[model samples]
Structures are given as C-alpha cells and as structure tokens.
Target: MSLSAHGAEGAITNALTIDVEDYFQVSAFAPYIARSEWDQRECRVEHNVQRILELLRQHQTQATFFTLGWIAERYPALVRAIVADGHELASHGYGHERASDLSEQAFADDIGRAKKLLEDLSGKAVLGYRAPSFSIGTGNLWAFDCLAAAGYRYSSSIYPIKHDHYGMPDAPRFAHQVREGLIEVPVTTLRMLDRNLPASGGGYFRLLPYGVSRWMFKRVNAADRQAAVFYFHPWEIDTGQPRIEGLDRKSRFRHYVNIDRNYAKLQRLLGDFSWGRMDQIFLPDQQAGAAVV
Candidate 1:
C-alpha cells in the first residue's frame, strides 16, 4: 500500500534512511584510511545491515538504503536481501567520495557508475541519490543537474543546519524542487530561537537524550506539519565493531559516544513515528504507477 493509503488525516509518514557503509569508510576516518586500503579492512557491514533488516522487519517498516557501490560489489547478496525485504534501493555514490571533493566530470562518473550498478543488481530503477557526508553545497548546485541527467529523480544530500564539515544553512528545511525535474530533500531540522537545530538523527541522535529527539519529531509533525527525514549508518548499530585509535578527542567522541544505546534508541524511534521509504514519502506521484514492493 502507498504511504498516503496507510495514514490517517494529517498524519505524517517520515522517511527512514540508512547510509550503508563500513566503519572505516566514514568521512571522519578518510584521512586515516585510503580507498585503496578499504579492501584490507575487516568488513562488518553485512552483519550490521542484517541486524537492521531484522529490526525493520519486526517493526514492519520500510526504508531506503543509500548504499555505496563498493559495498554492493563485495556483498551482492546483502543488496539483494534488502530488495527482497520490500525496501527502496538508492545510490550513496560508488566510493563514498564527497561530492564537493570531486570535479564535475568525476562526480558525474561516480554517481553514474553507482546508479547503473545498483539498478543492475536490484533489478529496480534507482531513483534517489544522496551525497556522502551531506557534502553538496552552493558551489556544487550543479550536482542536482548532474543527478537529474544521471536519471535520479531526487536527492537527500543537503543538511540545513550549520556544521563544520557540511551544511547549506540557507537551503530549504524540507523537500523542494531544485532543478526542473529533480527535487532536493534536505535532512529534517527544527527551527527554534531563530536557528535550525539538528533533529533528524545520526550522532546527534546518539548525543542528545531520547526525549529531545522525540520532541523534535513531534514538533515537526505537530507544528511544521511535515514529514521528518531521519538517517543513520548501519555501523551505528554495531557497538561491537572495531574502533580506530590515534584520533583526536572530538573525533573519538563523535564516532564512539552513545554507541551502546543506539539500538534501544532506534527501537524507540521506529515506534514513535510512522516511517516509510524516501520515495514513498517524498515522490508519491512519481511512484503512483510503479509496482508495489
């Protein structure tokens, strides 16, 4: 059934997304681990993702997996498992390369390669794309054009909050059209005291109390009257995964803080909100004639 069909009057069905990547592939560790060395690292993604799939299955929820081509290539069956379980498959680029770090041609090539690969593997037309680390900004507004040209219908790459690494503070706080045929869905945030506060999830979800996170989503639904887009990496749920050393205290905290509580918090999150895949929540019209998964 479609998201609209599942909801009551004025009920908001938020988007639940997973960034499918391993522990070492995170941007925080990019300086420490090279892409060439990615193969040498121990892979914990398959098990972590399986755990996620099981949790979602228990909740009877669906989500979009913004996967890396690198992971899909190595774990094709895991990719198939996600599709088999009635979830949406989207591109998170081939190598988890940041959009801002790549040239125009390189970015195009990366997304193009990843999109084709995922579509071929899943036997589904991948319609969404999210840049690694929410890296697209004003300088790369052209990335939207690139996405449209590459056959993507929309993107969830921008974060409206101000962050040291990535953010387009002036961007739309919710989903909106970027180019003629492409939509840009910024990560959900709440406006309070004239500033956009991080509400959607990730480390922020881990760092903040569950009550605060719950209140943010409640406000977005009750006051703003819009669906919230929440995202977290599969690695977040794997508290037992190996950790890197020699990092600064801040990096250590950002990556490791609240690791143990993630699963329970996620359980609460899944129950607190009505969740659905990104395409289902944001592109219902485009998905109208498509086969139900």
Candidate 2:
C-alpha cells in the first residue's frame, strides 16, 4: 500500500501494534512479581495472543508485534504463527528490562539478544525495537544509538507526554529520522490547548471513553494529516487472567480498569480506521532488506 494513499483525503491507514508480553511481566507488576518467578506464574500470553490474532484476522488487518524474547523462547510456535499470519515481528527486548535502568552496554546486549532470538524464530529480520514500558527517554538518548548500531532501522520507544515512569514530552509526535538512518516513531498524541494528550492505545484506551479515543485518531488523521500508531498488549483481552494483589490503587487502576470492555473497543477502533503493519506503513522500502535467518 502507498503511503500517499493513507495520507490522502479519506483513506488513512494507522499503524496497529501489539506489545507481546504477559500480564505478569508488565512494568506495573514488576515491583510485585520477581523476574525469577516468571516461569512459575501461569502464562496466558499464548492464548491471549491467539485471541488477538483471530480478531485481526476477522478484520483482515496486519499489525506489528513487538514480542518479548522471553515469550518467543518459550512459545516459538506462537512467534512462527504470527509471521505465518503475515504480521511484522519486532523486538521488545529480552527480560523486559527498562532502558533507563540499564547501562548503555547492558541495554545494547538486551536488545541484541532479543532481536537475534526473534529473527531466528520468525525467520525474518527484526528491524524495530520498543523499550519495555516506553522507558527510553531524554536521559537514555543513547538507546537510539545502540539501536542503530545493532541494525535496527526504527524504534517506537518514546511517548511524548509527561508521565512519572516514561515519556519524552518534547520528542517529535510523528515518525521522523532520529539518528543517521534510524527512525523514531513516538506514540500518537493530540495537541490540545497547548498540552499533549495520549491518544495511542494501552491502558489509556481502556481508561478513556471509546468515543474520545476515536475522535483523537480522527483528528490526527484529518487535521494533522498523519497516521497514528495505536498499541496494546495481548493480556488486555484476557480479562479472565489471574489478578495480582497488593498493587497500589493507582497501579491497579492503570492495569486492570476496563479490561472487560477493551476487546469490543478494539473492534470498534479496528473497523473505524484502516490498519497495516508498521513496516508496511512506515518503512516500506526496508521490508525487502529485512534480515533473513
């Protein structure tokens, strides 16, 4: 599909992305669940992902899956299934380590390991990387350099908003070249009354009214003339997954609110707009150059 087509008057194909990690591995739950105990916890990621796949299939849309190396290692078949279904497979780093918390070298190693593992399993070059929890920020600008050096062509790691955990409020709000050849696609946000509002997906999609989210994307497409990058995790649809206890009220709210309603909201979002794989929408030319293992 041509980029201009999406940019044209009535056909705007936004980027739909899935952050493929289990509920237990989420950053909000990191404080409560130790990484060492990950294997012991019930894993609902495979089924949750399959559900997402079915949803996408019903809509006949493709998306980018920023899969965790941990998940890919354990569910190689699921990773293969994603590729087999004609979706883009990208890296979400191994072990879900935050970029800000790791040294430059450690961050590089984490992405490198995950990228290679994903490429091997999916038999496709993993050209994109997203920091776990959108953790790459002003302090860790070196993360982009690491990504470029490690053969990544683009990154969707920054959220241009003010948040306690992660955001680079001043970063470009659309896809743009960051390093010499690397592109940084910040999460979609709307500028209203001189403030940036989160319109991209995630818990924000769950917490906010569906109409508001729909309006934001429509405004972005109609006024800004740019495709929005919408994202969510697999576990968002698995409302039946076991819940963790003792999380502060804020964490609980952010992670669990509107779980039962998200799947339908996603269906509405899917039907309202055109969608495509990230590479197809943003890095079209490089697709042929994607690494082959």
Q: Write the per-residue lDDT of candidate 2 for residues 1-293, one digit (tens) a residue.
A: 11312745578889999999999999889889999999999999999999999999999999999999999999999999999899999999999989999999999999999999998887799888999989988898999999999999889999999998888888878888889879988879999988799999998999999999999999998888888999999999888999898999999999989999999999999999999888887886775435584
lDDT of 2: 0.90
TM of each candidate vs. truth:
0.96, 0.96
The per-prediction tally of clashing pairs is 0, 0
- Alpha-carbon local distance difference test for all models: 0.90, 0.90
Residue pairs with backbone overlap in model 1: none
- Cα lDDT tens digits, model 1, 175-284, are 88888778888888999998899998899999999999999998988887788899999999888888897888888899999989999999999998899999888887
Steric clash pairs (candidate 2): none
Q: After the best TM-score superposition of candidate 2, give how far the Cα of residue 266 lies from its true spot, in angstroms.
A: 0.7
Error of 1 at 4 (Å): 8.9
Model 2: residue 203 alpha-carbon error in angstroms: 1.0
